[model samples]
Structures are given as structure tokens and as C-alpha cells.
Target: RTLLSARAPVTLISTSGDPPLHIAAERPSAAATLATLIDAGAPLAMRDGRRQTALHIAARAGNSVAVATLLGARCDPELRDRWHRTALHWAVVNGQLGAATLLVAAGATVNGVPMPIKKHLKKTSLPLEAPLHSAARLNPASGAQMIELLLRAKADPNLRDQFGQTAMQVAQGAGWSPAQLSLAWEQQYVHGLDYLRAGSNHSR
Candidate 1:
């Protein structure tokens, strides 16, 4: 939690840890740690146990500082996780708007495709939905804002999940109000689809 503290003085920050920052970023928290480490002169592109870099951590954590730190260090934004999801993928899913913005600015692929629903168990499951699907499911202010972020960044609106569900479909399934859906989609052409998939499309 040292690196996560807003009170941590930036200058006294020592990035020392076992395995160095490069190999430590495989885990979400570790990846976040590595971002600061790399910013402090740790290896720039080392992959962790999962072959993921610090950027992946920032993406998962939704920390814009981590994202920019990695990008500034020349970390690959397009680096894929074992499941083939990129940092961009995680940024949208986890709702890291600032990181998401930096990824776009750094030339990350806003149009990156979904990984594929390789598994879905109650114990462990992520359907490899599009970033849009992930965001819509959140139905938060960031969710709507991310739609615009993705659209302006040129993410594909028509991409589908394993169930052939569109982002709009998932958003509707998550129960976003018609007003919410309409406002989001109207801002970008993504909601133009009928969201025809058969699901609740509702959210918390």
C-alpha cells in the first residue's frame, strides 16, 4: 500500500522489491508498483509472470498516473495478457478514465477487439466482452464518459461479445435507463444498434 498512498512523498519513494519492477507487474497491484519503479529507473519493458507489464496493472487498477508513467517510459500499450486483452481493454473495463485517456494519447488501439469468452464459471469468469460491454455494465458516470472516450478514440461500436451481444446490448442488459442509453449512444453512433440481444442489460 506504500505506492498507493496519496500521502507518499514522491521523492522518498524507493521502488526496491524482489524480482525488480519488470517481472513484478504480472499482478494488478504489482503492476502498479512497477509503474513507480520504472518511473524511478527500473527496467522499462519487463513482463511479469503473466507476461503483462506495468501498464496492465494501471489499466486494471484504473490509475491514470500508473498508465502515464508506463507510457512515458515507453511501455507497450498494446501488450496482450494471457487472455489476449490489452491495457486498453483493462482501462475501459475497470473504468480508469485518465489512464484510458493517456492510452489513447499514446497511440494505443482504441479499436482493439474483445478476447473471447474462453470460460465462464461462477468461481472465475470474464466473457472477453468488448471494452464497451465492460463499461456499459458499470453504468456509472465513467461508463457514459468512457463511451465518448472510446468513440472519440475510434473504438468500434459494432464489436460483439461471445454471446453475439453488442455494447449497447450489454448496457441495456445492465439496466441503464433509456435516457442514459439514449444520451450515450446519441453522443456516439454505438447506441444506434437496437441492442437486440435477449438479456436484462440492466445494472447496479
Candidate 2:
């Protein structure tokens, strides 16, 4: 409040590449602070040096309230950072199920394609994947539930990444045993089938 009264720049980036809004969004008590910033005319869409908005930081930290607050402030949920990963992508990658749910409900793209980022060599091309792929490869413990949520959002399970691998295939190669993969797939398939059957019966 005092800073805002003093006309302090709220969008200034820190040495760690975070702005005040981004830092505020990372804390557990983010919602109130975020609201204050928003009320004080903080730029909700300002990107840090890493091109990550406060929404991105909030999603990555699994702060659903902050994510919701940012969304309500009209932050672009689809805005991608330097890695071309959106807030939804960060949420799923970090196993932030509540944040993911909020993002999905807000109409964030369930299967937003990631732009490839170059690694060691400029000549070496990296493969870009979707949010589900990141969830599968990076958040194994919650991967099944994450995938199910995405699938229910109409995400294309069979969509291939730049490496020509689907999320399931990536999961398999990421050391998910055959049994685990089969169980996850069967669960999702059965749930989807049941939903379809229910819809069909309702139409009758």
C-alpha cells in the first residue's frame, strides 16, 4: 500500500528474474497480496526476464487461489513463456492438480502445443510436446489423474509431439511399466466409454 502510494514501479524485475507480482504469486497467501497488487494497478500481464507472467509463477507454485485471482483479472492463461509453455503446462508439469483444474475450467487449451527450445547446440532440435506429455513425463505420481482431467477436457490423447510420440508413448518411455500404462489407459478408456453410454442413454 505504501509502495503504491509512493508510485513505486510494480513491474520492476529482480535479479532472480521475478517481478513483485510474480513473487507475490509464489507464496501460499498469494490471493490477498495478488488482489492488493491488482487493485493498485499492477500490470497483470507483465512478463519477467524469463517471459513468465505472475500467472505462470502462481500455477507453477500450485497456488490455485492466486491462479484464479489472476484469471479473474483477465490474465491470458494461454500466454507462453520463453519455453512456449503456458500456465496450464506449468501446472500440470508441477502436479498442481487444483491449478490445472482451474485453468481447464477457465478454457485454457488442454492440448496447447509447446514450441521447441534449443538445448546444447543450436543445430540440435528438441522435440516439443503438449501439457499432457509434460504431466506424463514429469509428474508420474499424478500423471494418471492429470491425463484423465485433460482427456475429459477434450484433449486429443493421440496427438503426437514433435518427436512423433504421443503422451502415452512418452509415459512408456519415461519408465512407466507396461502394467502401469495399461491400467491407466484402461481406466481412462472405461470412464470415457461410460460417459458416452450415459450420454447416449440420455438422448434416447
Query: lDDT for each of the candidates?
Result: 0.68, 0.79
Measured over all alpha carbons after superposition, the RMSD of each candidate to the real structure, in angstroms, is: 7.6, 7.5
Give the 10-residue window scoring lowest on summed lDDT in candidate 1: 195-204
What is the C-alpha lDDT profile of model 1 across 131-193, one tens digit per residue?
777778875567999988888877777787777777877787788877788788775684364
- The Cα RMSD of model 1 versus the native structure comes to 7.6
Q: Write the residue-wise lDDT of candidate 2 on 44-81 in tens digits.
A: 88998778899999999998889989999999998887
Candidate 2: which pairs clash? none
Model 1 lDDT at residue 95: 79
Residue range with the least summed lDDT across 10 consecutive positions in model 2: 117-126
